[model samples]
Target: MSAQDRLVGAATLKRLRLARGWSLADLARAVSTKAKELGQPLDASVASVQRSVARWESSKGPILPGDRYQLLLAHVYARSAHGQLALSVGSDFSELLYALGHLGESERRLNDLRTLLVRTATDGGSGLLALLGPSTQRVLADALADPSKLDEELLEAMGIAIRDVNRQVGSLPFVRVQLMLTPIVESCRRLLDGTVPDAVLLHLRAVAAQAYTLAGRAAFETRDDEASRALYAAAAGGVGPPWRRAVVHMSHALVTLYSTPGIEAAQQLVDAAVRDARAGESVMVRARAHALQAEIAARAGSARHAKAALALAWYDIDSDCDGDPSPASFSAAHLRGFEGLTELYVGDPSKAHDYFAQSAEALHTPRERVQHAIVSTDQALARIRLNDPEAATELLHGCVDAASATGGRVAAIRLRRARAYLRPWRREDWFADFDDHLIESFGA
Candidate 1:
C-alpha cells in the first residue's frame, strides 16, 4: 500500500478506544462529531464513518479522519498502552487551534502531550508512561455562560485532564503546563458563580489549587521568586481536599531550594507542609516534606536539624514504598541523590561520594533525568571538595549538557557552585577545557 493508504496499526487505535471502553462505532462517532464541530469537512454520516472504522480495524485501509485529524488522534491516543503516539501536523498545532478557538487549551494539551512523549524519550525509560484517569474532582468551561448545566461527565473529564497534566510535570517544561491553567482557573471562577452542587464546588476548589501549584512551580523553575511565592499562596487559599492542600505547602517550601539566605523561611514552609501532610495522613508526602526539611536545615548550617530531618524522611519513605508511585517524581534514587547533596554541603565528601555513586546508577527513569543532571553537578561538587579536579571536570561536562538541554534550574544553581570551585583551578589546563565548554553550553 502507498504511504497514505497504509493503516496505522488498528490494534493501536482499537486498544486506545477499547481501554476507555469505546466501541469501533463509538470511536467513529466521536471522531466525526469532533471533526464536524471544528469544521474539518468530514463526511461523518453514520454509514461513511462505519466503513472507515471497519477498514481501519481490518488493516485494509487507513482510517478516515485519522489521517489529517492529528489533534483528534491525540485526544484519543495520547495516553500510553501502545506508546507515546502522536502525528505531526506539518504546522504548529497552536495556530490551527487559535483559528478553531482552542488556542490556550490546545497549547496546554499538546504541550502536556509533548512533555509526556518528547521529554521522556529524551530522558530514558519505557518512554511515555500510561496516562492515568483524570481526577474527576474538577472541571471548567470557558465561554460556557450557563455552566450551571455542566454535566458530571465533562467535570470528570477535566479532572482526568488535570491528572494527565500531573503526569507531564518533572518530565516536561513547567511553562507548557502553565499556559493552559489560566483558562481553567477562569472557568472555575465562572462555575463558582453558577449553580454547581456543594460537592462539585469543593472539587473545583481543589483543582484550582492544583492549577495554582503547577503555575507556581513553573514560576519557580524560571527563577521568578515573587510570582512563585504568590501563586503558592493562591493554591493554599480557599477550601480544598486535604491531600492537595498538603502538596501546596510542600511546593511552596521548595521555592527556597536555591536561595542561599532563605533557609529559615524555607524551613518554616516545609514545616507547615509536614504538619498538613501529617494531618492528612499522607505519609509519602510527609516523606518529601521531611527531605526538603533536611535540605533546608543543611543550608542553614544546622547539622542536628538536618540529621534529624533525614532520619524522619527515611522512616516515612520506608513506611509507604508499597503504595502507588507518586504522580510526580520522587524516586528512591532521588532521595539518595538528595542525601548525597546534604552530605556534600553539610557533611563529608567521602560520604556524599557513595550516595551519589549509587544514585547515578539508579537514575535511569524518564522523570529522573533533571534530577539526574542536578546530581551529576553536585557529584562534581563533591569531587571538587575532595580535590579531584580531573574527576570533577568529566562529570561537569555531562552536567552542563543535561542542564542546558532541559533548562534545569537546579543545574543552574549547581553550576554557580561549580564555577567557584573551578576558579581556584584556573591555572590548570583541565580547568580551561571545562571553562570553555561551560561558556559554550551556558554562555558565560
Candidate 2:
C-alpha cells in the first residue's frame, strides 16, 4: 500500500466537502435534510453534525462514518457527482448510491404510470391510445377496424411476425429491432383495447404477451430497466403455456439481477421459471432455466449453488426430448456462454476461457454480433486473469467495433469491465491506444 492509501479516507472526506464549497454547517444541513427525505431522520442537529464533520475530517477521526451517516453522505455527494460518485467515495459506496438513486427514480416513474392508469380509468381511456406515436396510431387504426377478424390464420400470421422480430433481436442491431417492436406492441395495445369477440380473448392475450416480452427484451438490452420491468409484468400476466411463462419469468429474473440489489427477488423469479419449465415438459426451456439459476447463484457468490445449477442445466440439455414450439431459443452455445460467465464470477479463469472458446466456436456462421461482443469480452477478462494482458487487449480491440455498431448496453457494460481490468497496464503504449479507441467507440 502507498502512503496516499493510508490517508485517503480522511483526506477524501475533506476533499469532497471542500470541492463542493460546503461549510461544515452547510454539509450538516444537507445530510440531515437528505436523511429525513430517506426516512432515516438522523437525530443529530446542525451543531452536533458540524462537530461530527470536523472529527471525520481530522486525521484522528474514525476511518469512516457509521452506516446511516455513510448512506446519507453518499446520497448527498451522489446528487451532485454527475456520474463521478465513485471518485468521491469508493466503488462499493457509489454502487449503493446508484442503486438507491435508480430505485427512487423508478418508483417515481411507477407512481406516475399508476396515476395515469387511475385517470384513464376515470376518464374512460379515450386519450390513452392517442398518446401512441404516429406510426403506431396508423397501425392501430387499421387493426381496430378488424377487431372481430382475429381468426386462426390471422393469429398465425401475427405469431410468425413476432417470431421474426424475436430472431432479429440478438442478431440485428438493437435499434433496428427496437424500432420494429414499438409499433407491434402498440398494435397489440390497440387490439386489447378495441371491442373483440370473447371466443379469441385468450389467444389475443397470448399474442399481446409475446409482444410485451419482445419489448421487454429490447428495453433491457438498451438499459431501460423500468420499462423492462413493466413490460415483463404485462408478459407474465397474459402469457399462455407454461413454457412461454417460463421464458418471461427468466427474462424478468435477468433484468432484476442486473438492475437492482434484489437478489432474493431474482431468485424467486428464476425458481418460478424452473417450475413452469418443468410443468411445460420442455427440456430445452428447463435447461435454460437452470442456466439462469446458475447465473443468479454466481452473482450471489455461491460457487456450490452455481455449480449444482449448471450441472442440472447440462443434464437437461444432454437428454433427448421431443420438439418444442416455444419461440425463445436456447442452445449449446448459449449454455456455454452461461458456463463461461458463471466461472468468471465464481471459479477459475482457465475454465472460463475454455468455456468461452467453446461458446464462440458453437455460434452459428455469421455469428450474432451482440453475442460476439459479449463473449469476446468474457474471453478478454479470462485472459487478463491468466496474466495474458496483450491477448486480452487484442480480443477486446476486435469486439469494440461490433459493440459500438450494435449499441447494446450489455456489450458496452462488458467492454467497460474489460477496460477496467486493463488499468494496471495503462502506462504501456498499447494500453494508451486501446483506451483512446475504447473511449472513441463508446464515448465514455
Candidate number with greatest TM-score: 1
Worst 10 residues of 1 by lDDT: 128-137
lDDT tens per residue, model 1, 1-444: 233323334444554566657777777777677667557757558567766666655555444333355565544443333434322221122222222221113344445444544444324432211221222222222225566656666555555555555555556665554544445555655776677766566666666676678777767777777877877877789546565667887777766656436567777777887777667656677777778888878877788888898898888777755553343435566678768878977899988988998898888654566778777788888888898878998988888877776567778778867988778889989888888888898787
Off by over 4 Å in 2: 1-143, 365-367
Question: Weakest 10 consecutive residues, lDDT, candidate 2?
Answer: 83-92
TM values, all candidates = 0.68, 0.66
Candidate 1, after superposition: displacement of residue 106 in Å? 27
Global fold similarity of model 1 (TM-score)? 0.68
- The clash count of every prediction, one per candidate, is 4, 0
- What Cα-based lDDT does every candidate model obtain? 0.63, 0.71
